[model samples]
Target: MTKILISIVGPTAIGKTALSIKLAQHFNTEIISADSRQFFKEMTVGTAVPSTEELNTTKHHFIQHISIKDNYSVGDFERDAISKIESIHKNNDIAIMVGGSGLYVKAVTKGLDHFPDVDKHIRTELNKRLINEGIETLQKQLKSLDFKAYQSIAIDNPQRIIRALEVCIGSGQPYSSFLTKTEKTRPFKVVTIGLSAVRSIIYDRINQRVDIMVNEGLIEEAKELLPNKHLNALNTVGYKELFNYFEGEWTLDFAISEIKKNTRRFAKRQLTWFKKDETIQWFDYTTDINNIINYLEKQS
Candidate 1:
């Protein structure tokens, strides 16, 4: 039997998790989450991890499977996900992978481009600059060093900017130059399902989800992780905004608003990244599960 990996992708708060559960149940297979934020054990409510009821509906892999302190990267996830998919395929003909992290999903479906190992000191210096001068400084440096990366990569993401900058500086070549620009073949067939909505609708959904997260004690979750704010994993949208509030840089209400706004921006960037892949089959967020299942059935 041929193995098929069904990847469910979309922006935040766009129903990827719910749809993935339905697909997993329908196929009688397990799900592998590629959402990087949900991998940390310390981030639950803010990361929007699935509820207990949803996990009971179908088995999931890689959810809260690592600590925030663990130095997990996209490369690490790619290796681990491939191993898990192989194991799952031994028992079932299909496995479901679902997440909004386009890069991680790409890492699983197509192997990552190899770049020269960067110097540790380069990264350390970049992190220092990020803390002192702000992300804009790194963004400008990347733009000057590699215009292509500055335009295409998520510029607002400080981690991404720093990574690109380090690669450019360490190698003395444009970061984009190292991108193989070619897809590496995988052992199993891949079918990507993208969920999307109008820009306004997506923003509205993100705002509502932020409100729900707050109501579900996202503030408390952020508070618990506050001490680790300097950790790369904790420098994320939900936690970062709250950390600012904790620092007296912003009021609680303003922090919550920033969370919603930043999430909406993050969603936009996710869509921008996924849209570059022509292989994805897009669907409205409200698409019927039966219709999606029928589509998958035809592909299988």
Candidate 2:
């Protein structure tokens, strides 16, 4: 029998968790989350992690299994996720990878380049430059170095810019150069299923989801993780907005609005990233679960 890796991907709040659980139940296998933000244990509500009842519907791996303080990277995720998938495949011929994080999904599906490790001193210097010189300076540098990556990356993201710069400086090669065009082969065959909906509907869903997250104690979750807001995990959409509010830099109204704005932008970026992969077979979120399962069954 051929081993199968089913990847479920899409924008946040687009019904990934519900659909993934249904698929896992159908396949009699566990799920491995690829959402980068959902890995931190401290980021439950703000990260919109699955509820206990939903979690109980099927076993999930790599969800809330790490700390915000841990220095994790796409490299770490690639290694650990591949290992977990192999372990799951030992007993089950099928395993599901589910999440909205486009980068983490790519890291697992296509192995990352082994860029040279950055020096601690270089990282500290870059952090200092980011603080004193501002992220736009580095963003401009990256734009000059790798226009392709700059076009795709979140320009407002200081961490993303800094990491790209680190790779460029450390390896003395453009970060874009390392994104080798050749696809990396995986041991198991992959079937990518993308959940899609009308664009306006998806945006509306994201807006309502943000409001519901606020109602469901996202503020409280942010407060709990505030002291460690500098951590990369806390640099995400919901928590960053609340952290600004907590710092008195923005009113609660402005912070909430910012969250919605950033989240919508993040969704757009996700679409831009995933749309490039022609392998994904998209489905309307309104489609019947059985319809999707039957599609997968045919592939199997």
Candidate 3:
């Protein structure tokens, strides 16, 4: 029998988790998460991991399965997710993959692009530059070197900027040059489902979600992870903003506002990335779950 992987994608706080749980329940199968932010066990509240009830309701893999200290990459996740998917297919014909991280989702469905290994010293030097000269210095360098990659990556996130710069400097080629236009083939059939809403609605949802995260003790969680703020995992929006607040760099109110603003920007980037793929079927965030299930069942 042919297996089907239902991929749920959308902006943050747009109900991807709720939809994934419903679809998983309908198929009586498990879910594989592609959200890189939620991989760290210490960063739960800000990551918006599924509620305990939801986790109990349906099995989910790769949610907070690693620590901030662990070194995990998109390539590593691609291999592990494929293994898990194949294992799940041994007993079930349908499995669901869900997240707002477009790159991770693409990694699993379409194999990662091959890049030449960089000397560790290149990344080390870039990190030192990031701290000494500030991210703006390196950002300008990346823009000068690879404008395409610079435009696509998260400019505010130092980790992403540094990663791209390292590859560009190390390989002596544009980072985008390494992004293979070809997609790898997967054994199972894939049906990508995207959830979206009007820009105003998406922004409102993000603001509200950030408020909830704050109420749920996002500050304390971030404070706990403050010492590890230098870690690549802590280079995310919510925690970074909070870290700024803790360091007296930004007022708490300002930090909270920054979190919402940065999150909104992140959502816009996500929609832009996923919209480029014509294969995805998009629906309003409030679209009925039954309609999606019917579509998947037809695919099966």
Q: What stretches of model 1 exceed 4 Å from their correct place? A: none
What lDDT score is found at residue 295 in candidate 2?
92
Stretches of candidate 3 exceeding 4 Å from the true structure = none
Best by lDDT: 1
- lDDT for residue 82 in candidate 2, whole number 0-100: 93
Model 1 C-alpha lDDT versus the unseen true structure: 0.93
lDDT of 2 by residue, 124-226 (tens): 8887887678778888888988888788777777778888888888888888777775668898989999998888998999999999999999888888778
Cα deviation of 100 in candidate 3 (Å)? Answer: 0.7
Model 3 scores a C-alpha lDDT of: 0.91
How much lDDT does each candidate structure score? 0.93, 0.87, 0.91
Name the TM-score of candidate 1.
Answer: 0.98
Candidate 2 Cα misplacement greater than 4 A, ranges: none
